[model samples]
Target chain A: SAVISQKPSRDICQRGTSLTIQCQVDSQVTMMFWYRQQPGQSLTLIATANQGSEATYESGFVIDKFPISRPNLTFSTLTVSNMSPEDSSIYLCSAHLWEADTQYFGPGTRLTVL
Target chain B: EDKVVQSPLSLVVHEGDTVTLNCSYEVTNFRSLLWYKQEKKAPTFLFMLTSSGIEKKSGRLSSILDKKELFSILNITATQTGDSAVYLCAANLYSGAGSYQLTFGKGTKLSVIP
Candidate 1:
């Protein structure tokens, strides 16, 4: 398992503003993923952050709305641009540990747009 | 598209009772199945089952995978109020392109009363 940390545990931001959530892992990892969970809904994959390359986003998510940055193996950031009430959700970051088949997640960022 | 499905969308049980969560998946190049517990925040890693017929145990929680049935089951014995949370099931899809993404199912919400 990986020791992962995320910034801004909870935040209420104004609509049209952007918030960047940071994810830091204590150990190096191969892949980092971003996810979103709407109220009363299941988690939805946002993107896969590949080191030194562009992220691969899932359907219903695009780079223009959620830009990801992975400069190295232990850290990544996700920016929610042009936030809206519909975009209000918990954003989570996860990484797959080499020693385990499971992916460990960081404490999610709870964003509420006003 | 790869998908995962979990049964008993929600369950309410008293403490000391045993609860079982089920997850079934259909994915190409299936790799592994994982279980997580989400309690108000991030989903914490619980167990990961890779091979069939092998059960993974952690304290009062144990999980087993059945590859032939394309499903897995997590059993929590002597459950407590602290065990109340959303139990999530995810499957790792090992794409031949040297990448894998976890497909999650709508979690089963378990509420344990004292």
Candidate 2:
């Protein structure tokens, strides 16, 4: 089990502005993932952020829109660029601990684009 | 494309009642089934089941997986008002090299009314 944390738990930003959300894990993880959840909806995988490599995004998400960075085994950041009101959602980061083979999630960043 | 579906999108039950949530998935190279409870922005892990017929329990929550049936069930016994939230079901797809993709269901909104 790993403890995950995110920065700026909740933020209100203007449309067209970008926001970078940071995620940090307590221990080394083999893989990290980013997810987004819209209101009254379930989570959607944004991308897979593996250390030392480019993030693999899921369909409907792209690097230009949701760029990801994995600098190390325990730290990752996701940037929501050219944000729009439709981009308002809760972004969450998860770390998959190889020892447990389970993915633990961060608190999630709630973004409101006005 | 892989997909996960959850049944009874929303349910309202009285406190002390036992409720069961269902999840059916068709994920390529399925590896595991996971359950999570979301009370706020972040979802807290509840259980992860990798094998069929094996049950994972934690206090009032118990979950079982049926790979043969391609489904899983989460049973909450003696529920409380605190249990009111969205319960998510995710299918973990193994893609080699210890990397996996988690596809989530729409989730079941369980409202435990007092």
Quote each prediction's TM-score. Answer: 0.97, 0.98
In model 1, the runs with Cα more than 4 Å from the true position are none
The true-versus-predicted C-alpha distance at residue B102 of model 2, in Å, is 0.6
C-alpha lDDT (0 to 100) for residue B68 of candidate 1: 97
What is the per-residue lDDT of model 2 for residues A1-114, given as tens digits with 9 covering 90 to 100?
A: 789999989999999999999999999886999999999889999999999889998889999999999999989999999999999999999998777767889999999999
Give the worst 10-residue stretch by lDDT in candidate 2 chain A.
A95-104
lDDT of each: 0.92, 0.93
lDDT of 1 by residue, A19-109 (tens): 9999999999889999999998888999999897899999889999999999999999999999989989999999988677668999999
Q: Which parts of model 2 are misplaced by more than 4 Å?
A: none
Note the clash tally of each candidate.
Answer: 0, 0
| Interface RMSD, prediction 2 | 0.6
Q: Write the per-residue lDDT of candidate 2 for residues B6-106, one digit (tens) a residue.
A: 99899999999999999999989998999999999888889999999989999999999999999999999999999999999999889777689789999
